[model samples]
Target: MSEVQDSGGEKKKGKKIRAKKHSTHIDMTPMVDLAFLLLTFFLFTTTLSKPKAMPLIMPDVNEVPDPSKQTPVDDEDAMTIILSKNNRVFYYFGIKEPKVEQASFDATKPNSLRKVIIEKKKECESRLKVGGKTPNERHKVVILIKADKDAKYKNMVDVLDEMNINDVPVYAIVDITPKEIEMISGL
Candidate 1:
């Protein structure tokens, strides 16, 4: 709101020869109401986006296998991927042991960890098909992800992304054993 007034000095002649001046006032109530309405509309209609998160299913600690009753995962059906420092990737077809072959990460070439995952999945499917197993009985390719203590978190994330891209059904992050560490250091 605003107002303007004129002083009585303009009639100093005392002849009263002046038109009456009106004080100018502007009502700001409507503008204030409009501003509040817009604020309320935006507050009610605007959507707050939620943050995205990757889905990770962790195994329970109590689910540890009993050595006597547990059946070992077949070497042909399991693939282990080792993540190390400098974004290096090493893999073997089975559990970590001496004489296991090593492979480096190669995004441009077809012979990458990604390729190994795909091939292993196909191989598992074919083996199940030949065995006259039903679809439900077919074995899914199991992937073991082992990260060295010196590896970057980014490298682990990249490997996880590769797992998702390759559609691996069963994969777990396992700690590298002493023997596996020695094998990596020797390489």
Candidate 2:
């Protein structure tokens, strides 16, 4: 706050005269204190964003597969997909050695691998419903993903993404068998 007051000066011709100017003073202490308090309050109340995490389910190395608790996935219900180099995909129903067939990565073409995955999911769900299974019981289409040594990493990622998109619940990346190598090597 500032205030001004007239200062008496020397009288001239018996008339009183006042000084022309007065120094002004201002108080900034309260404003500075309020600014610091607001700053401190905001610093204490603000929350920092936490890093997001992806849910990863790792297989237990020591735990063996229990037979009684495990419901056997029929070979006919299982689909095996093999990713090779040059954007090639080989898949088959049932075991890898006896009945392996080839598929293409192109989604536009008929009989694409994505269509096969959707068909398998529908077939598995329908079969479970016919067997009098409840909604709570998760009957998923089993798919085994095998990648060759020279397979593109992008192709492997794309296959995994397809599994997710198709809602295929039971899928794993398995080692390629010698028979599978020989079967595809003919191409």
Candidate 3:
């Protein structure tokens, strides 16, 4: 808002009548109040986005482990993924003598890591008992993640992200044995 005020000064040297000088004043209190009001309005109306987190369930430390009574994962439903140096990924199904196969993280490739994860998950799900009506009732696919000492941390994170993106139910990060390191050393 603006207002015009009489300066209350008359020129003595002027021969003819002239317009009187007026000073202009602008009141900024209302503008400041309106800005604060809008700021508060927006602050009250909007909801902040929650942070994203990867869900990981760990076994209780107090529970005594019984190896014999533990549920055994079927060979068909078990997939082991290994992260190696230079962004190398290797995976093999089952615990028996594994035939390690190289995989790529590139989505554009035919044999991308994401595609492999999805395919393995489907394969495991297909073998589920027929009586189970829903995905929860069926057996979960077990994925074991192992990273070599020389493997980059980013590669491991990428592998975990792939597992999450593909919805692989049961995945665990395990220590890589020296033998496994030797297995991928040549690659």
TM-score, every prediction: 0.63, 0.63, 0.65
- Poorest 10 consecutive residues by lDDT, candidate 2: 1-10
Give the residue spans of candidate 1 off by over 4 A: 1-51, 62-72, 96-99, 129-132
Span of 10 residues, lowest total lDDT, candidate 1: 1-10
Put down candidate 3 lDDT per residue, 73-161, tens digits, no spaces: 87777888999877889988888877789999898798888888888887777665558777666666799999987789888778888
lDDT of 2 by residue, 135-169 (tens): 74645689989999999988987888888778777
The candidate with the higher lDDT, 2 or 3, is 3
lDDT of all the models against the reference?
0.76, 0.78, 0.81
Query: Mind giving the per-residue lDDT tens digits that candidate 1 earns over 62-118?
Result: 987778986467666788788787777887775544355566467667667777778
lDDT score for candidate 1 against the true structure: 0.76
RMSD of 2: 11.6
Q: What are the runs in model 2 whose C-alpha is more than 4 Å off?
A: 1-58, 129-139
For candidate 1, the per-residue lDDT at 89 reads 80
